[model samples]
Each structure stands twice: as structure tokens, then as C-alpha cells.
Target: MANHPDQPAFPFRRPNPLRPPGEFERLRAHTPMTRVTTRLGDTSWLATRYEDIRSVLSDQRFGPHLHGGAMGWVGEARTGDSLFQDPPGHTRLRRLVSSAFTARRAEEMRPRVREIADSLARAMRDAPRPLDLAAWFGYPLPITVISELLGIPQEDRKQFRAWSDTFLAVSDETLAAAAQAWSDLNAYVVRLIADKRSGTGDDLLHALIAVRDEQEDRLSESELFMMAISLLVGGYATTANAIGIGALHLLHNGQLGALRADPSRVAPAVEEVLRQQAGGGEMRRVAREDVEVGGVAVKAGETVLIPLEAANRDPGQFADPLAFDIGRAPNPHLAFGHGIHFCLGAALARVELQEAFAALADAFPGMRLAVPAEEVGWSVRLLDEGPKGVPVTW
Candidate 1:
């Protein structure tokens, strides 16, 4: 792809594993809101500054819905995911899911999360030689928790993970695979919803189904299917990646010893990890109208890409942004994003991370990377970036 003179190419490469692309820093310093050519060859405004990114996300002028109310989804209109919806629709769907993801509800799951984490840690400790922490612990912990919460059968969880992997894959080469995954997941969710409708259970899916059946205009059948997919996608990939990346940060910076020494720091340490290890491609939004951002005029219909990783590291937002300090106070990072679109599963992710880290710290105090640091592979294919596998042993 040829780069325009005024626009740098989108998806800039990350030269350093610990920081965002050097180009992001350069862009922030010079042109905070410059044009960039997207992978799809569309020109979009790339927002890198902390304030600018927040404005773009918070402003109603920039919406997730594209022109003519059409979304990126393959099939019919009503079946579109809420992530791609705007205004009243987004508001309604968010309301339906928000009740289930309340802070109290998430807090109630902490003990259960700790139990799952402890079980994974024990398994990791007993495994022969080196084990991939991500495969053994990071991935399965969240999958199990979400599975139990959503009432998915234990036998079906692995297939869900595979579908999730494909859906979140970042490459053009994986487009067909992603589509197939979407079809498979959609069909499975439809069947799951039907099963739940037949007999209500204590699971969140059953509760949602009840709401759909009893409440008027609360949730449509299409929305129900998309909601289940959203919950699975939103609740799974990001948490799994965060766990893997957070583990790497702790191991690399000798923070594991600190965490083991004082497990009370696990919570704050998780926050620091969230801040430092926030890695993902830019978020996409289309301008609903002409808007001025960081003194640059964005015309209607123009796509805007907010680089969260860069915004989280802006020096204006955090002192010594590059340093990995767990105790950094007043940290308002955009790892979970900003504004109304802020992650609904933020509380749950925090609980899972806190418990997972605490359990790992307690279980494998002497853990070290089994492979050389440079040899550790990352998942370039996924929208969220993290170690493909963290091979480690005590």
C-alpha cells in the first residue's frame, strides 16, 4: 500500500514490545489528528493524543454506525451486533446487558474466579516441564468463567474458543475463516437460546431469554443472538490477552516477586498491567457530521481511528508513561476505553485478573520464562495483541 504524503499508513508496526509504535509518538508530537490510509484503502483520521481520542469516542458526532445505518456484519439488518449500532438501539442493548454486568454482580464472582484461578495454577504447577501459561491458564480461566455464567455446556466451550479466535483474527487472509466462525457461532447461539427458552436456568442467557419473552420491546430475537455473540467476543478475547500480557510484564520486570511478597498489591498491579500492556489495533468510528478534533476538521462520513494504546501512554495523561510502576496513582488509562462505549465487562475483567495474578503469584513464586525473551511469539493475527503462548516453569 502506498502512503500518502499527508497521511501515514494505518496499522503502524511496533518496533518495541513494551511501547506503542514510534510513529504514534511522532504523530502525537507533530500531527495529533492526521489522515491515514486504512487496510481497506479508505482514508481515515487517526487520533493519537489523549484528549483528542477521548473527544472522538465521547462525541455523538462520531458514531459506530456507518452511512445508511449499515454495519460490517454479513447478514440481515436486525441481527447486527450492538457494537455496530448507534443511539437508541445501542442504548437499549447496553441497558439489557449492563444489568447482568453490574459491579456487585462482578464482585460476587471474585471468589468463584479465585477458585478457577487456583485450580488452573495447581494444574500448571503439576504439569510436566515447561507449560504455556496462556494455553493452560490465561485462556481457559476466562472461558470457564464465561461458560458457567452463560450456561454453555462444558463440551461446547472449546468450540466457542475456536470461533472467538477466528472472529477476532486481524488479517485479510483470515476473512473467510472469520466469516465461517461467525456463522458457526451464530447458529450455536440460536440453538442455545432455543434451549434456554424451553426451560429457564440460573444463567445469564436464561435471564436474558426471560427478559426477551416477558418484556415488551426489550430485546428482539435477532438482538438476542447478537447479544450472546457480543458477550462471548467481548468477555473472552480481551481478558485472555490481558492475562497473558500482564503475566509477561510481571515476569519481565521482577514484579512477580513483589506481588508474591505482598499480594495486596495484586489489584493495583493489575491496573498497572492494564495500562502498560494495552495493545490493540485502532478503534473504528465514522463521523456523523463535520467535527473539529485537536484543531483538525473531520468531515462527515470520514472514518476515525482511535489508537487506545497511544492515548494511554500520552505523557500529558501519565507521568513517565513508559515506566512500569504498579503504584502509579490517579491513573486514568483508556485501556478499557472512555465514554459511554467504555467496556461493560470492565469489572469482571478486573476481578478475573486480580484473582488470576494472586493465584499465580502464590502458586509459582519461582516461575520464569521457559524460552528466551526474544523468542516469545505474539499474535499478530488477533485484534488484541499478546503472547501467543507464555512458556514458563517454576
Candidate 2:
């Protein structure tokens, strides 16, 4: 089939592994907002400029709940996904969960996070040759942290992985299986909430229940359950990918020595990693009304897809955007997104990533990829981007 402008040039290509060389520069040289077909057979307006993306994200008109309306499956959800909410509703849900992710609260979790990272690092250090860091360190640390936070029993994590895998998979077979997974997951969360009610604990679920029934302050059972899912899924998967991929990048780019020499550099390195990582897919939006963004007229109901990876690397916004620079000051990257929908767990993600990289660099200063970079396995259609396995050895 001839390549369609709307369809990514390589539909089956893994997101991070097949990132088009100089994609952002090419988009910037062109104009913003091109018509593109999503993997799910929907047409969307692709927004590439940084300013335009930020505006569209903050604007109330292009909502995340487009699926709930008459649009059907525009490949975006109306409910069950907190990212798809609009104002008042979005505000309410955000407020309810804000306490769990505040800077202070995340900071308080730092010691525990570090302990988790270190334990995983030690395990990796003592493991056999050709260790897959993604499975060993990257996946387990965040999974452990989020499971502990959600009060999920360790025994349930295996099922959690199966459900989450089905949830993120975009293939027809997996898509067909997701509804069942969703049902099972919702039931599981409901039971967890009930358990929290009967036996009080310090976890966020208990904290949520404490105030769930106040007048003008409450979360529906569905909302609470879904929000918890969002935290667990978003919290664990995204950071895990970043840690694994960031470690790979540092190893490949010959910067692990620099990071080891000065652990403080891990902070800036995390930001750069966020800037460089290719997110799994574009952020989807629809025109609330007639809007002119990036000199393009977008009519109501037209879908807009903002590629954060592309925008973060737009040369007009970041000098030498393609080159990863840990010292890139005034970075202003949109990796965490922008506006009211800005990431609530960003502070926690950063702390985990910093601790992870610092510990990894210090422990295995001689670490190198066990295979060629191109040999790393990549799954194209996931919600978060990274290698399926990153084999490394010191």
C-alpha cells in the first residue's frame, strides 16, 4: 500500500527503535498539524510544534472523552481512563488524587524508592551473565513500589502483569481480550477497596476512603478504582521504561562514567532521558470548536495527535534537538506533557529515575549492552515505549 500521510511511515515499527531520524526537524521545516491515520483506523490532526501542543493540551475544547460522545472508538476512552477527563470532572478527580502524589509525599517516599532501587541493583549485580536489565531492575522496582502503594498482594502481581499486558496491547487478538481484562481488573479493585475499608492502612486507597463520602467530596467506586489503575499502570510502566532505556542510552553513549563520577548529574540526565525517549503514541485531541493552531484551521470534532517526542526535539524549540545533552539548560521539554493535564507523578518518577541511574552507574561502572543496540527487542504497539529486553553485562 502507498504510504498515507496520516499513517506512520512504519506502522509495525516499534516506537523507540524505529524513530525516524531527524523527524522533528522535518516536521518543523514543514508545518504543524498534518492529517494522519491512527493505528485503529481513525484520522487525526498531528500537531508538531511545542507551543501549539501546549495550547491544545491546556484547552478545554479538545477533550479526552471523545469516545464517550458520538465519536465511537476514536481510539480514545471516555471513562476508566483518567487521562480522558475534562475540566470540573478532571479537576475533581485530580484533586482527589493530588495528595498521593504531592512533592512532599513523593519526597517522603524517596528513601523507600531508593531502597527498592538498591535492592534491585544488588540482585542484578549478583545475577548470571547477560542479564536483561529491563526484566530484572527496570520492571521489578517500579512494580514493587506501585504494588506496595496500591496494597496489591505480591501474589496478584503475576495476574496484574497479564491484565496490564492485554490492556496495552493494540493487536486485534489482544484488543478483543481487553474487555474481559478490564472487567476482571475492575472487580479486583473493588474488592481491594472493600478490604481497605474493613482493615485501615496507610496506603493511598485507605486515605481515599477516609474522605470519599464527605459532602461535595467523593469519588464514585468506578472513578476511584480506575484512578488507582491509572496510578499503578502509569507509575510503574513509564518509569520502568525510562530507567531501562535511559540506562541503555547512557551505556551506549559512553556517559556512564560521567554519571558515576558525579551522581548529582543524574537529575539533569533524567530530564534529558525524558526529552529523548519516544513515547509510545501521540496524545490525541479533538477540536472543541473552530481553532487556529500552528497556522492551521482545525474544525470541531477533528482529531489532533500531538507527538511529544517530535515536539521535544523541534530545533526551533531546542537547539541540536536530536543530540542528547544532559546539560541542556532551559530544556522546557513537553515529555511529561503541559497545562492542567501535566503529569501528577512527575516528581516521583524523577526521584525514582535519578536514584535508579545513580545506583546503576555506581554499581556497574563497567556495564555494557550484551548485544548490539539494534538487537534489543522492541514492541511496537505498546502504550509506553522501550525495549522488550535490554541485555547488559559488566
Pick the lDDT winner. 1
Residue lDDT tens for model 2, 1-394: 2336645442334434634345445556775666666655556677778788888888877776332222222234426436447778788889877877888988899999999888888988888988889888888888888888878889988788777766665466555577677667777877878878889687777777766645324577556667777887787888888887787788778888899998778889999988877773555777779888888888887878777777787777889776778877888888788888888888888888888888888889899989877777776435566678889988
Cα RMSD to native, each candidate? 2.6, 3.3
Q: Report the lDDT tens digits of candidate 1 across residue range 246-350.
A: 888788777888888998898888988898765656567788889898998888987788878888889989999888888888888888877788889999999
Scored by CA lDDT, what does every candidate get?
A: 0.81, 0.74
Give the TM-scores of the predictions, in the order they appear: 0.94, 0.90
The global Cα lDDT (0 to 1) of model 2 is 0.74
In model 2, the runs with Cα more than 4 Å from the true position are 1-24, 65-83, 213-217
Model 1 RMSD vs true structure: 2.6
Clashing pairs in 1: none
